[model samples]
Target: MEKLKESISSVLPVTGIVFLLCFTISPVPNDLLMGFVLGAVMLILGMGLFTLGTDLAMTPIGNHVGSAVTKSRSVWMIVLVSLLVGVFITMSEPDLQVLAEQVPGIPNMTLILAVAVGVGFFLVVAMLRMLLRIKLSHLLIAVYLFVFLLARFVPREFLSVAFDSGGVTTGPMTVPFIMALGVGVAAIRSDSNAENDSFGLVALCSAGPIIAVLVLGIVYGDVAGTYVPVAMPQIADSKELWLLFLTAFPKYLKEVALALCPILVFFLLFQVTKLHLPKGELIKICVGLVYTYVGLVLFLTGVNVGFMPVGSFIGQLIGGMSHNWIIIPIGMVIGYFLVAAEPAVHVLNRQVYTITAGSIPQKALSTSLSIGVSISVGLAMLRVLTGLPILYLLVPGYLLAGVLTFFSPPLFTAIAFDSGGVASGPMTATFLLPLAMGTCSGVGGNVVVDAFGVVAMVAMTPLITIQLLGIYHKYRFRPEEVQEEEAASEDEDGGDIITF
Candidate 1:
């Protein structure tokens, strides 16, 4: 019930905006509106169940596996396990599936394989970094430098998709497990920086897909594919609306099952060999898995079947108007509330709060994320209006973020990068991406060039805002008081290592 209320509060503002737009400025078709409403309901319900299920099942499983692997204390064992886990989890990610399907001129399997391999390689790097105590900022700077250097050689169309992949790859299905794995691995250390070390797994993993897809873009050279608009469903009656969601249910059911299967299989294997436990706990996890399956199936069905069409339709409607510039503010408003609607976001927020012992409040983090995303959305709309090149924004945005890493607290830098991927989860992919594409179509712009970078934009801005939050945190207190807090925190942290 607590989870349900969170989902409701998160989703309600966005839903309200959509309804207002439908009836007022950007009137949607009856069928699309109905579908959007229905999707909102499913989204809220699915999110609630999914969050609860993740707490019960995914977190524990990842925690156990990570702890088991680290306990082995063999570099080879850790590397091999991390590699396999990264590959399987990335391959199974539902957001990656959605991304693959939308990208043209690339075989879905080919793209999936490339992305999985990329994430696998990076996951190993992340593990090694944690073990070696490498500076997250230095590694990020080097990796992003390499990423942009390679970006220069990729085709224009592939550039946006490549960057967007980084964000979506570390989404709802990936964040909980990966983050828990980070916690488990870092728990072995009794050092002061252990908490900070636990965070950059998702940050590094996000980069892997970008590099992989960029390589693919170079190899496949000039495969800038055309965008195909979603066919607006023509629902004549209530029964047809029901049938639309009903039909989508099976496809998502299969997709979510495939997504969850590798994780489940991996967990079961760990349980048999490493994590021997009593029956009661096992039963609870199994129940949680069921909830996860149901929640994901419903969530995907709602968003893809229900939200996608409406988002695109509304975008087209608004973009076709004489004063299409209204999209900027509208986009900003939606983006502000949209991050809260992301299931993975709540997971990240709770984890941060617990790990930091409330030194960094959830409300503050949430507000910063909302502000960052709002600005990013407005920038994205501006890009669509002007057909601006993505590199113009990305290069500077990332450079600024990298520079701030030196000034901001290390923990904030890590958390900010992770938040980038988390902010652009299923909601951004399903709704915002489609909305951008639809607006591009309506405006007669190059859809691939103008609309495809929204996810990347959503991913980039939080790096600035959160680190600014960190800088604020740093100066908010006097040096001695800050020192005292750090000393006190380190002393207390022995008992504060978050356990699943």
Candidate 2:
């Protein structure tokens, strides 16, 4: 019940904001308004169920696989298994699919497969990095350096989408499994470094998609793109609106089913050959899988069917207004409330809190992310207004993030980057991206260059904000260190006096 309440809190603020906008600045037809409300309800239910399901099902599987694979103690086995896990999880990610459909000049499957391989390959690197005790910062620096260098050669049109790919690829479906896998792998080490090493899996995994898409852009040449204007559904009555949602449910059911199959099959294979847990535990896992599938199907259907069109409509309304610049503040406001709505953000925050033994509280993490995402969306809107290049913002932002990593505690740095990836999950992709695209369409901006990087921006800002939180934790806890130093000095002076 508490979880359900929390989920409601996550979804309600965004829904309420939309309602306020509808009644005031961006009113829609009665049927559409009603449909959105219905969607919001479905979203609340879906989020609650999904989060519950993740706790019960998805995370355990990652843990089982991570620990089981590590137990094999063969480098070949660990790398091969981690890579396959990454591929399968990335393949199923709805956010990646959504981003792929938006990108031009590539087959969706081709893009999806490329991004999956990127993630898979990087997941291998991440797992190996932990085992070898490499500095996450060092690896991150080289990879990002390579990413930026590659970006210069990739066409301007592919730039925003390429970066956005990194953010969205690590969505709700991937975060729990990959994150738990990190924890599971890290569990093999009883040393102090285990906790710290557990975090960067999502961070490294996020980078893979960016690099892959950049290469794809260079190779695919002629990746220049145009926006597909959002076509609002025509619904005359409440019954039709309900019918629309009911219809979407089955399609997503099929998608979620197909998506879950690889992971399930892999787990079953492991169960028979390696994991061999008792029957009771198997029954629980099976139950949780069912919950996860149902919840996800419902969530995707509601968000796409209900939220997408409404978001585009609102964006258009705001964009076409005489006070179009208001989109900046409006975007920020939406961003503030919106992060809570992402099912994966809760999962990341909970995992962070648990991993840190509550030193890094979920509330602190959530607040920083809300502020960061607000700024990101505001900047995204600024781009919409100004036609600024995304590269201009990204280079500085990543550099600052890179610099902070040196200053931040290793644990904080990992959590911060992981949070950045988790923050830009399905909500940012489905609602916020469409919102930006619709606004760009209205304002006559190049949607691909301007609006597309909203997810990338969403992904980037948390790197700064959460690291800033780490920096705060540094300062906030400094007095204790100072006191210890003072106490040591006093003891030394007292000893000298006694000797005298």
Candidate 3:
């Protein structure tokens, strides 16, 4: 019930915002409006079920598998297990399908396989990083330096897309499983550092797709193509809108089923061989899996049916105007509210709060993500207006994020990088990216360069803004520590410190 309320609250603001625009500034067709209304209803219910189901299913499965693999204590087994787990989860990521379909000229399977291999390789690296107790910061710096070096050589057309792949692969389906796996692995260690180390697995897994796609760009050369626009559905009446969603639902039911099978098979195998838990827990997990499937089908149907077309229409309308500079502020507002609707953001925030004993509030995490996405959308609009190179924005943004990792606390650094992928989940790829593409088309900008990087921009800003929070938290508590110590001298009594 609490999850339901959170889901409603998360989705309502954006719905209201869009309704205000439809009624006042830019009226939409009645069919689209009604479709959106129904979609919002589905989104709320889906989010509620998905979050609850993740708590029940993905969390326990990942924890169980993670600890079991580590307990085996054989290096080859760990590597083989991590690699297979990474590949399987990624192959089924819904957001990756959205991305693959959108990228012109690349065979979907080819791109998907490359990314899977990349994720598999890096999951192994992440597992090793934890076992070896290597610093996450050092690994990130080295890997990203390599990413930039490779970026310089890859074709210009594929550059932003490569970076965007990293963000999309770590969507709602992937994050919960991988993050819980990290926590379970870290649990084997009995030290403070284990908690800090648990976070960067998502961070490293996110990096793998970028490097893989970039390598593909080099081997394939420039497969240049135009931005293929999303055809906004023109429904004649209410029934058509309902049918649109109803039809999409079954397709996703099959897709989500296929997606979950590999993970399910792995779980059942583990249960028989290693876990052997009682019947009650097994029944609970099975029920949760049902909830997960239904919720994802509904959520995907809502977004693809309701949100995507409406977003594109609005972006086209706004950008078609005589004075289109308002797109920046409009885009900023949309970006701010839209990210709240992303399912993965809640997962990341919950984990951060749990790991930090609530020292890092979910409210703070959400705010940082909102501000970061708002800034990103604004920059994306600027790109549409000016046709600036994406590299011009990404290189500096990533460089700053990298430098800040050095200054910020290790936990904050890990959280910051993970937030990058979380911030650009399915919602950003479908609605927000299409919105950018539409606006760019309306404004006569180069859509391929200007619009393609909305996900990349959405991913990048969170890295900087969240790290800034860490910088602030660092200073805010330093003086507080001094003051508390001084006050302790006055009382001559001591207690454990509390700082946020």
Candidate 4:
């Protein structure tokens, strides 16, 4: 019961934010009230269940599979299996589906499949990097440089969305399991330095979709999608509300199944081979899976039905307001709260604090991420109000992040890049994207060129902010050591004088 309450508390702020946004911004007559109540309840329940589920089901399963693969004596088998696992899991990510649905002019499934394959290939590369102990920063520099160069050739409109894909591909469904996999694989490494290797999987997996989408732009050729704001439906009666919930239920169930299947298959394979958990543990995991399913269904329904429409409406209202300058500050507020609301951000900070032995505090990470996202949201709003090209922002953003990579600690750099992807989770998709879309529609700008990059911007800013924190940490810690040395010298000098 206490555990359940903890989960509810974790999820409530996000649900509350969605409800608040809906109440303030929704266009439908009764939607604000109806959505507020319904969205809050459903979202909280969903989040609690999902977090519990991932803890029980996904994490263990991913870890077991990862360990099993590492224990396999055959290198060829590990590589083959890793690649297949990567592709399968990438195919299952719910966020990717959301992204695919929003992208116009291409078949949704085709684009999704392409992105999955790209992620899969990269996941294999990431696993291999860990096995070989390759430096993450060096790889990131090369891949991002290639991505920027590709951006030059890709249509201007597709550039931001392409980078956005890199970030969104590492959503809730992907992060926990993939991180577990990294931990599992690293655990099995016989090398004394295995811990150092665990840090880079998320960093490397983030690159896959960017490269895939950039190639997609080349193939699809500069076709931009039109933005349409989702209309909020009024819930006049209990019957209508019940029907809406029922309708949304199956969609999310299918989504959860799709997201869970690849990891499940790997688990099954592991159970058959070197990685067997006790029957009781397996049963616990099954229960967790149920929680995950329930949580995801509720989470998606609340966000899509209530949050998305509200976000779009607010963006439109604010963008259309007589005092349009308010959008910047409002956007900053929204971004700050939204990052705090992301389930994965909590996970990232906790994990980083644990791994770094408190060298990186959760509060510091949260503060840095919030500030970074705030700036990004402000910039995204500016993009909507003004017709500036995404490249102008992205090019310099990546360059700055890359330059920082050279100066900061390798672990901080790895974590910073990973945070970029992790920061823009489901909240960014369901709320921020819709907000950008609505604002773009209100301003009569190109949705693909203008609105599509909010996720990209949200993702990019964290890379800079987290690294800046790292720089500060390094500087401050050095002074403390220096002060300690001076104090030791004074003590020695006083001991020699004695009488004074």
State which candidate has the highest TM-score: 1
Question: In model 3, where do residues sit more than 4 Å from their true spots?
Answer: 478-500
lDDT for position 114 in model 2: 83
Worst 10 residues of 3 by lDDT: 490-499
Candidate 1 collision pairs: none
Cα lDDT tens digits for candidate 4, 1-500: 54457556555665565456545643434645576567657777776777778778887887787888887857787788777877777777777777777877767777777777778888888888887767677788898898888888898777777877877888888888888788788888775446555766776787888888889889989775554457677777878876776788888889888888877777877787776688999999989988888788888887777677667777787777676767777788778867876667756776677766777778888889999999999998898889788888888998999999765655677778888888888878888998888888877788878888888899889999988887777566775664454346335431111000
RMSD of each: 3.1, 5.4, 4.2, 6.4
Candidate 3 or 4, higher lDDT? Answer: 3
Clashes of each: 0, 0, 0, 0
Tens-digit lDDT track of model 3 for 1-500 = 99899999889988888888788767788888888888888889988999988988988888898898888899998899899989988989989988888888788999999998889899999999988877777899999999999999998888878888998999888899899899889899875467667788888988999999999999999876656788777798778887888888878888789778978998998899998989999999998888888888888888778888888887788788888888899889989988898998888888888878888888988999899999999998888788889889988998999899766666788888988888889888878888887788889887766778889899999999998998788678776674555356325422112223
Give per-residue lDDT, candidate 1, residue 490.
Answer: 43
Question: Sorted by TM-score, highest first, which candidate order results?
Answer: 1, 2, 3, 4
Residue-by-residue lDDT tens digits, candidate 2, 116-161: 9999999999999988878787789899999999999998888898
- Residue by residue across 368-478, what tens digits does model 1's lDDT show? 999999999999999988899999999999999999987777788889999998999889999999899888888999887789889999999999999999888877756
Pairs with backbone N, CA or C atoms under 3 Å apart (clashes), candidate 2: none
Q: lDDT of each structure?
A: 0.89, 0.85, 0.85, 0.77
Q: Candidate 3 lDDT (Cα, whole model)?
A: 0.85
TM-score (C-alpha, index-matched) for candidate 3: 0.94
